[model samples]
Target: MRVMVFVKATEDSEKGFAPTPETMAMMQAMGKYNDELRNAGILLTADGLKPSSEGKRIAFDGPGRRVIDGPFAETRELVAGFWLWEVKDMDEAVAWVKRCPNPMPGPSEIEIRPLYEMADWQE
Candidate 1:
């Protein structure tokens, strides 16, 4: 099973707050977890993302086009980073995600979802 682990964004993240020393240390711990996953042959890829301010959102409708810039949302529950990992099942994916350090300073969240396999689409 392949899973996507979402690293949620915070208010400070939208305002371009750099990671604090404690946050950086937590990230380092995450890196160690990633390394362990890789060694166990589960992790496919993982990385943090730049602030959403650098991103662009495109909207299109019937020949009308618009592009909007980010820090798009005022919500704290936005994606800031992600990890793609292969595991035996959803349970394993959940276990890995459970072990991750909180990625944000306050009220952070991580969402883990299994990726759809092509075989699942076959009927």
Candidate 2:
């Protein structure tokens, strides 16, 4: 099964604050964790995102599209990064996430969601 792991953004991340020394150390730790995942052939790809201030959004209303600029008002709703992993099951993905280093200062969160299989569309 494939899963998408979301690294939730904090206020600091939305504000475009650079990682602190401690946060940097945590990132280094995460690097080692990523290496482990890579060696296990579970990590397909992963990347961190720039702050919303440098991002843009396209809104769709029927056939009309509107371009909206950031930084968006909701920091809590923004995603900071993501990881794509191919694992045996949700259980395996959860185990991997449990080993991740704290990616930010203060409270942080990560969400694991399963991806739909290609077969699901064949119905």
Candidate 3:
């Protein structure tokens, strides 16, 4: 099975604050862990995203009419990064997620969701 691990962003992340020394160390550890996954042939791709302020959001209600802006609110829980991984099952994915290091000094949240499979439509 394939899964995406979402690294939820905190206010600091959205504000472009760099990770602290401890956080950087944790990230390094996580990178090593990801390397382990790659060695085991599970990790596919992984990367962190820039601050949301660097992105834009577009809302389209109809053809040729749209509103575009950025630094959206209610984004406190948005994903700051993600990892694409291949695993055997949900349990395996969960185990891998549990091994991730916290990305922030405060509470850090990681959401794991299975990737959609074409076989799902065949049934």
Candidate 4:
């Protein structure tokens, strides 16, 4: 199974704050964890995203489209980064996530959702 792991954004992330010593340490820990995932052949790809201030959004409604500037509100709903991973099952993915280092300076969240295969759409 393949899963996408979402790293939820925090206020600091949305503000594009500089990294602190603790954040540096956390990065190191995350590196080690990523190494483990790579060694296990589970990690496909991963990367952090720039703050929403540097992004753009497109809204669609009934064949109409509008471009919205970034610096969007609702930091709690923003995504800071993500990981694409292949695992045997959701349980395995959950286990791997449990071993990951904290990706933020304070409270944060990681959401794992399975990807839909083409077969899923077949009758």
Candidate 5:
């Protein structure tokens, strides 16, 4: 199964500042985990995004497009990073998540959603 894992943003992440030494250490730990996953052949891709302040958005309504600048509000809804993994099943993915170090300083969130390929789509 292929899944997309999203690491949600926090207030600190939205500030668009560099990570502290502790944060860097955590990131290094995360890198180790990523390496393990990659060595196990489960990790396909992973990336950490810059702060939301450097981002932009486009709202669409009936063919109308409105561009909005970033530093967007609602930190809870923003994504700070992501990982794409291919595992045997949800259980395996869950196991991997259980082993991951906390990605944020305080409480944070990671959401996992399976991706659908064309073969599974029905018209």
Candidate 6:
């Protein structure tokens, strides 16, 4: 099974500020965890995103579209980063997430969702 692990954004992440010592430590720990995942052959890809200020959004309605610039609202709903992993099942993914270091200096969240394969689309 394949899963996408989302690192949800926090207020600090949305601020796009410089990294502090605590954040640096967290990054180091995350690096080690990523290495473990890679060595175990479960990590397919992973990367952190820049703050939303540098991003854009395209909204679609019917046949119309609107371009919205970021620095979007709702910090908690923003995504800070992600990882794609191949695991035996959701349980394995949950186990790995449980072992991960804190992705933020303060309280944060990681969301795991399974990807739909072609087989799932067939009746």
User: lDDT of each prediction vs. the true structure?
Assistant: 0.81, 0.90, 0.82, 0.93, 0.91, 0.94
Off by over 4 Å in 4: none
Best by TM-score: 6
Model 6, range 5-95, lDDT digits (tens) per residue? 9999998888775778877888889999999999999999999998999999999999999999999999999999999999999999999
TM-score of 4: 0.94
User: How much is the lDDT of residue 31 in candidate 4?
Assistant: 93
Per residue, candidate 5 scores C-alpha lDDT tens digits across 7-122 of: 99999777764778988899899999999999999999999999988989999999899999988988999999999999988889888998999988899998889999676887
Candidate 3 vs candidate 4: the TM-score winner is 4
lDDT of 5: 0.91
Show the colliding residue pairs in model 2: none
How far in Å is the alpha carbon of 80 misplaced in model 1? 0.5
Better of 1 and 4 by TM-score: 4
Q: How close is every model to the real structure, measured as TM-score?
A: 0.87, 0.93, 0.88, 0.94, 0.93, 0.95
Residue-pair clashes, model 5: 0
| Residue ranges of candidate 3 with Cα displaced over 4 Å | 17-20, 65-67
Those runs of model 6 whose alpha carbons end farther than 4 Å from true positions after fitting are none
lDDT by residue for model 1 over 9-107, one digit each (tens)? 877666664668976787788888888889999988887777888888899998999999876766566778888988898888888778777777777
Query: Which has the higher lDDT value, candidate number 3 or candidate number 6?
Result: 6
| Alpha-carbon deviation at 49 in model 5, angstroms | 0.7
Q: Per-residue CA lDDT of candidate 4, range 1-108, in tens?
A: 899999999998887757788878988898999999999999999999989999999999999999999999999899999999999999999999999988988889
Residue 49 of model 4, lDDT score: 93
Model 2 lDDT tens row, 1-123: 999999998887886656678768878898998999999999999988989989999999999999999998868888999999999999999998888888778899999999999987896
After superposition, which runs of candidate 5 have C-alpha atoms over 4 Å from their true positions? none
Report the error of model 5 at residue 72, Å. 1.4
Clash counts for all predictions = 0, 0, 0, 0, 0, 0
